[model samples]
Target chain A: MSPSPEILTPERILEATEDVLRRYGPTKATVVDVARALGVSHGSVYRHFRTKAALREAVTARWLGRTEELLGELSEEPAKTAEEKLRQWLAVLFEAKRHKAGDDPELFATYGVLIQEASGVVDEHLLVLIGQLAAIIGEGVRSGQFAARDPLAAARAVFDATARFHDPVYAPQWERPEIDDEFRAVCELLLRGLRA
Target chain B: MSPSPEILTPERILEATEDVLRRYGPTKATVVDVARALGVSHGSVYRHFRTKAALREAVTARWLGRTEELLGELSEEPAKTAEEKLRQWLAVLFEAKRHKAGDDPELFATYGVLIQEASGVVDEHLLVLIGQLAAIIGEGVRSGQFAARDPLAAARAVFDATARFHDPVYAPQWERPEIDDEFRAVCELLLRGLRA
Candidate 1:
């Protein structure tokens, strides 16, 4: 062992892996390359994560975590009326997705390619997001701002209803001049639909 | 020139091209293969469609036309209330999508692959479906059963809102046991939203 090789922590491995992924893309990026970037052996990296799939999951989860944290603030905010909160939440979500799809298209494409292979991380991320929407709707129902029988179900409905604005499959349409107008129109209809 | 080359027609060529697409799939099915399937020269196919792209566009449009015709009946139905028409319309749309996604996954996938290559056929198809939706919403507004200011905009909003139920990207989620429940719940909320 070289005298005091930099400490092998999961955090360091993840950062290195993300860097390697940025360079080689999802398809060509390998655990060994990540290990090389970290100046450690592949076995050292695997000690923290059982498999490459696990490592990928951790990385994706990390990326999605950022978005969730940002939204979590809105979900927990106590001041805004539910209508205002819902509108802000959705606009922020759409903007966040647009930035992800536009800012670093290469990284976004890498995530798109790797997402299928990452397995439950994406599903879990979705559940977390839907849960956030549920919390807001639950509050809306409690305050008599919405008339839904079930906040969880209502949250899911709103989420599904706005899929075109946020779903990666429709990302190409985001560049159209009328996307914002369409988003607002949908939001208006949904807001009207959800009002008590 | 041959005495009789089976008297090729555009309809017959389209029928054979559909068969070839079903057999070889979108990626592998070419103009030459379609021509070979028709027992004619590629030049003969070109004479009708001008280019291979034109042939692909024609085949995709024909397939989409079937769906448009199916929904057109519901859009024009004058007997039912707007609410019932909307409910029936959504259910029928969901069921149709489910059948397309579930009945013959290979054929569905072939269509999915070919769709990207078919240019504006999918967009035109979307406009047709949205127009059907607008017709129903317009009647609702005129009857004072719905409060939407712009029926066309409301139709688009509703269409985008229901993307999860019909969008091919979410096709895998259609298999979930809870999908029907989720769809109905969304429909209920949307109906409530649209009510005057």
Candidate 2:
């Protein structure tokens, strides 16, 4: 009925873990629950991810990886100016975070706890996001559209400055009617600061 | 004696409550403990503050009010240009947060929980802080040093933009060696954005 133990893969294990985490929430979810959902042994799950912590971290990574891929593709659009791309990037980030927070609040909250536990995974994810931000700032600098001595530093500043819109800590404020206005004001000011 | 019932004022009760919270934390601290600390009865404490929740909110407001007063004074410096005052205001706010988080970590953590439990107090605190920021920006607008049409809106934008430096959620990151540089970069960009 279920896939053979020999055919079990890391991707399949991670998929099962995500659903298990959402259903049970992060605190109550266990490796055995994931195994039960998959119709396999916990030992088989451990074969793919050595420990429960490791398995949880892998699930967090996979979830974050999807966002990274989507943003990475969005940054590659050649038709838009760098400023346009940067604005779009910020808006998309805020929307993604808002949708995640609003669409499935239970899973969003579960990941919030998981994020605190898997700091290494989160740190790596932040670095990738910053890298993507830096690339767009660098493009603007090269095109004489933005003026910054260090694109990386400017990128970090921009990212930190906009944290209110995307930071999970402020997710409750995301649904406020004035949130879009606040987001736009921050963006306008930052773009003016960056313009050559 | 430890002040008669007639003299057991709200201020004295709040002072005792702050000490008690620091010692036992927000979750464990009780009105009975505050009363004991002040050599008074629980009924006496309740007379000054009707409920445990009310007492904790008062303590939180008193703690936040001190910083608000300090920043309000700094923003009123008549001799300094608005830009200098703005830069100094941001730096001082960061320093106050760093000191609070570092000086007595136990107390800092106790208040962090207390703050969450007392959101109304925090919201009022934010409004006062934003008003102080708007006063400085209003001065800048008059002197032709900044370019915002609405000082209140700009004040909110500035406050939200630099949240990473002063927000309690980011208190742990304040001590990073590179945090100072990051602070400077964000301030520089923001000041540039505000310049006329």
Candidate 3:
């Protein structure tokens, strides 16, 4: 039988790193720890990532890549109003939390670190995405699809509303299958807050 | 000189604990840490609280106590509109972050924890406060004093908007001295979104 292509690409490595981060935290996770989880040799990991920091960077890149995809989908979606797009984004975030791969310990540990780096490094892609969202909001205001106000400021508030989803404090309580109702309540509130 | 009761009470202990928490996270903070910071002996601290967990509970109580005070102030702020009260609540949260006392690390860490806890354990209180905000909103809608929408849902949106002020992810960027401008903008958008 033909061998399946090796799954240890840089992206896959980063995914494993995210799992390790979630399971063991940055302080405890090691190259061997990550390799064992990925079913690869420690030396194989070293071939692509020379240091833990390098691997972390790759993982962060992967996360941003995912965020970018969501943003792209948001921009591409045929939502008629900014409010609809905002709701779409909220749905994406909620699903991201819900659909988290089971092996996401390293990703969880690295999650905080990634967010901090994005803010500090002026995560340009995030800024671009924010700016795009703001533009849509501005268009909504001009088109009388939303209230006329500072689009950028409104965009920030919407982003903050999603922050609660990432919180471990609430995430645990939200693990129940029935929590979709609460999630819908939150999303509806944001949409109502954004309505024209 | 007379000791004059040493000028410390359970209240003072709780306040000092907040300071210690701001300096160190929950892991590093101990009753002794609070004691030393408060300029009191370990025996005095033990006299008031027998264990670290007890002290933490007191700290949590104090934090809730402060939130209650803020809620009281909002109720009496003479705000003519729900938007006005919402703006005031945003200001309260902003102030909490800006003036978190004694470099309180534990208090800081626990703030998010406390928020989540309130949602679950203190749902009645949260819902009541939200209901009150909704009443103001309903009044505004009736008089054409503000945008007309489902006041209860809008009230909930206002609370969710405050989630920004509580999130640490945007702490550095959002907790600026002049957040009032951005806050006002959000209020304006929400008001517009609710406009009939």
Candidate 4:
């Protein structure tokens, strides 16, 4: 069977760790659990991650990285006006978070605990998101679409302002019937604010 | 001894509960602890609060009530222009939250947990705050100081937009030296958007 199919890659470990986390949550999940799922010894997991903390952090980074990649693509999409891009970007973020919260509640709850323990990963993720927003705002400023003097500040403001729709703290409210209307209203106000 | 000077009123019970919460945090705090601090029987506390959950919820509502009263006064200040009121209102919120998070971190941490457990109180607090914002926005629109179709929608947008400055989740960054500058930029952007 091609030497047991070599299932000890970092990617495999992370995937298995995610499963273990989803099953047992962050508090109860362990490297041994991850190793067991992969049919490998705990020593092999240690060889890859060094410690349980390292493995958890890697999982958090990976999860956040997926969101960054998704939003990054929207920020980079050419041809669309900055205004359109900003709207789409915020919409996607809200939708993505809602999906995560709604579609896979078990994994989402696990990540919530993991995030509290991995502030470094959360901070890095915020920086990347803010950077993407700044890039889009910079485009708007240069194209004379937005009149803001500081793109980065503007980006941060936009991020902060729409946080209710995206922040995990308000995740319970995201599924409410009026959430889409509320999201659109906030976006419209922001777009109006950014207009030159 | 002036007939032992009854100090077992509901107000006194709440005060003692707050002390107990500050000392032991939300999870470990109990009505018995509050009674112990107040030098009264737990039965006395129960007579005032009905149940431990009721006591905790009352304490949370009281804590949130202070902020609401503070902001409500600002919204009611008839002399100031809407723009000025909005500026002061947002500034005060950021300051108030920062002070709570900084001045008494132990209590702040306790309240953080309590607030999560007291969502009904929290939701009511948010509604009152938003209602006050809508009232202010309605006045601004009527005075021709701002251009907005729906005062409530505008108010919600403004609240969502400034959440980063005041939301408890971002309290850790509130003490950053540059936060004031960031706050100002957002206010400016929103004010510019609102100007008729």
Candidate 5:
């Protein structure tokens, strides 16, 4: 085993917790296992997280944040037209989620349970995503590319409209050959709707 | 204790099974409870259902069929324009689901579990709903009302777009005060998208 780090940080604890969760799944995973993985006392882990629930919530937030960070860059690209940015933004989001659900299904399943336990985190993540969409839509409206009086509402509608392409519950269907065609059709419809 | 029915039918068994599920939930609900509720022998219930899984599946189909029957009427209305029909159809679906979720939450929760266990039933129900949407969309396309090349694809997109208003996972949000406004805004956007 690698030597325990001299510093025990929340990030270290969270990283270890993810490993533990993957090893044990959600129901059986424990703070003690995370501590063991980190080669630290449970007290040290608790010192950073305060509680196991807090630790799990943080991990979930971290997982969701990665998607936000990736999409945030696309949303902020002033060089690209808002319409193009919006299209790429959605495509990227769908691909990221598909990869997470496909490349590491065990961890994906673990996060599914953790997400239920961390609804507040998930809610916050959703708001962040909607905010990203709203920003892109607001740009479109200001540029006279879209005809939305309420950019935020329009953004939400777009989000909901494309949910089958990105939502975790529909992950099982994402791998189907027809999903790409479906995604393109949805994007085309939304783009048409947005055209002023 | 009412007198047991002289003859047991699959319909009766399904009805009793729904009551049992409502009372005990999916996990604790059993074929025996259905039999007890109907004041009939377990053998009588089994003889009609063939197995407990079949009984639960039938109950799920029965629950879903109620919504189908309600929406089926809207899809068949010839006098209404396809756009108007599409608008009303989505509105009615959202209302129907919201009522089912709100009117009897216990039964709704019971059916949520039953649905997962009866995915084939759920899949068939989805196809029926999408088919209805496709027919309306095809009508729209033929009449020069909508611009979709693939009515079925457009129908699926519309379904996914409006999911938050009807999907069970988002049922909790359906009761929020602003949901009507949200639903209207989404419908407006989609209606615009379909405009030729």
Candidate 6:
């Protein structure tokens, strides 16, 4: 009789997949490679993900989930002024980049490549991540703490600045302390610009 | 003996390549294809450009030359205030996108694809286009017409915002008037955010 398959949690499989992606980029990260990493057969990997595309999506979802675990705690605090929220939020995002810089350079690069590749597909979960920043901007605008303006564009701009931290070319050259300070200054400038 | 080769002007070759790129994407727009478009042999095309890559670069150079022509004129004109300069500059960029939308759809799309693909390459000339925008921001900041800030970051924000026009998903949906107004508003908001 065929042996029953070993049970591998989705999280464990995802971790292995991320490791595989880090070692070999998206083009080379195959089910066989992932299965080898997990000490499981290819069928086990296939059970969790039907195709490579599905696997890639799951890997990205896993990364976002971790980002949420890192960022989700901030939004729970009492609401604050736009400047305060923007400063704290940019710090949170930058810290995540720093954390990855020390822990997993390849994975960080892989995540960026994946995000850029999937940007047009409109991942709902990623939007939810962005929505937290958007909510802060909305609160600022409504409270008259920020100038009346388009929250979505403002949030996107802030996100873009912070996201640059993930770029190896720019991030290494940049001083984090300076970038954080500039983040505050830039956010304040935007809020003042938006003032009704 | 081989027939004596006829020489074509660099200007004439670039024009033919642009026409070919507009008709077909970079991958399909081979030297042979360009030569056929110009009614010359592929060998003649090779005599002018060593490879397809060189030809593609020339095509991109031609596109940038036109953009630079407009930017050069705008830079020389004095704006009384940072806000006015920012708004007028946004209008100029959006107007260029609008003009391209009418004239050469494939060329614009291919340009975007090539730029994105060549993003990290040192020889990529996309930076020259962005540098012009950065120079304007730096000049504004130095002149004290703009806020004391990181001109590079501010420039990056403006470029990111302008990219909305280049998005394939949103391009068809874009209303010229709405984009022009939106760009103007966004630039005003950014300038406000950048202020001292």
lDDT of candidates 1 onward, in order: 0.88, 0.91, 0.65, 0.87, 0.87, 0.66
Candidate 3 displacement at residue A196 in angstroms: 4.6
Model 6 native-contact share? 0.30
Model 3 reaches an interface RMSD of 2.9
lDDT of 2 by residue, A11-108 (tens): 88888899898889998999999999888989999888878999999889988999999899999988899999999999999999999999999999
True contacts kept of each: 0.93, 0.77, 0.44, 0.75, 0.65, 0.30
C-alpha positional error of residue B156 in candidate 3 after TM-score superposition, expressed in Å: 2.9
Query: Where in model 2 is the C-alpha error above 4 Å?
Result: A1-6, B1-6
How do the residues A1-196 of candidate 3 rate in per-residue lDDT, one tens digit apiece?
Answer: 6576675788778778878877887668789999999898899999999887777766766666676676667756663666677666667766775555224644553565555544433366556666767777787788787764678877766665555564443555456764565566556655666665
Which runs of model 4 end up more than 4 angstroms from their true locations?
A1-4, B1-4
Error of 5 at B27 (Å): 2.0
Quick one: ranking by TM-score, best first? 2, 1, 5, 4, 6, 3
lDDT of 2 by residue, B42-114 (tens): 9988887779999888888989989998998897668999999988999999999999899988889888998
Candidate with top lDDT is 2
Which residue pairs of candidate 1 clash?
Answer: A193-B193
Indicate whether candidate 2 or candidate 3 has the larger lDDT: 2
TM-score of chain B of 4: 0.93
What lDDT does model 6 reach? 0.66
Q: List the residue pairs that clash in candidate 5.
A: A161-B161
How many clashing residue pairs appear in each of the predictions shown?
1, 0, 18, 2, 1, 5
Q: What is the interface RMSD of candidate 4, in Å?
A: 1.3
Candidates ranked by DockQ = 2, 1, 4, 5, 3, 6
- Which lDDT tens digits does candidate 3 get at residues B63-165? 6566656765675666356556655666765667656632654455556554444444355556666776677678677867666457777677666555566
What would the TM-score be for candidate 5 when compared with the true structure?
Answer: 0.93
TM-score of chain B of each: 0.94, 0.95, 0.61, 0.93, 0.93, 0.75
Kindly report which residue stretches of model 3 are placed more than 4 angstroms away from their true locations once superposed: A1-28, A32-50, A77-83, A101-122, A135-144, A147-153, A166-170, A176-196, B1-51, B79-82, B101-153, B167-170, B175-181
lDDT of 4 by residue, A1-196 (tens): 5886875799999999988988888788888888899998999999988788888999999999999999998877779999999999999999999999999887788888888889898989999999999999899999999988889989988887788988887888888998899889888888888999
Candidate 1, residues A1-196, lDDT tens digits: the string is 5976677888888898899999999989999999888877899888999999899988999988998999999877778898889999999999999988989989888888767776688789889999998888888899999888888888989998998988777777888999998999989888888998
The TM-score of candidate 4 is: 0.92
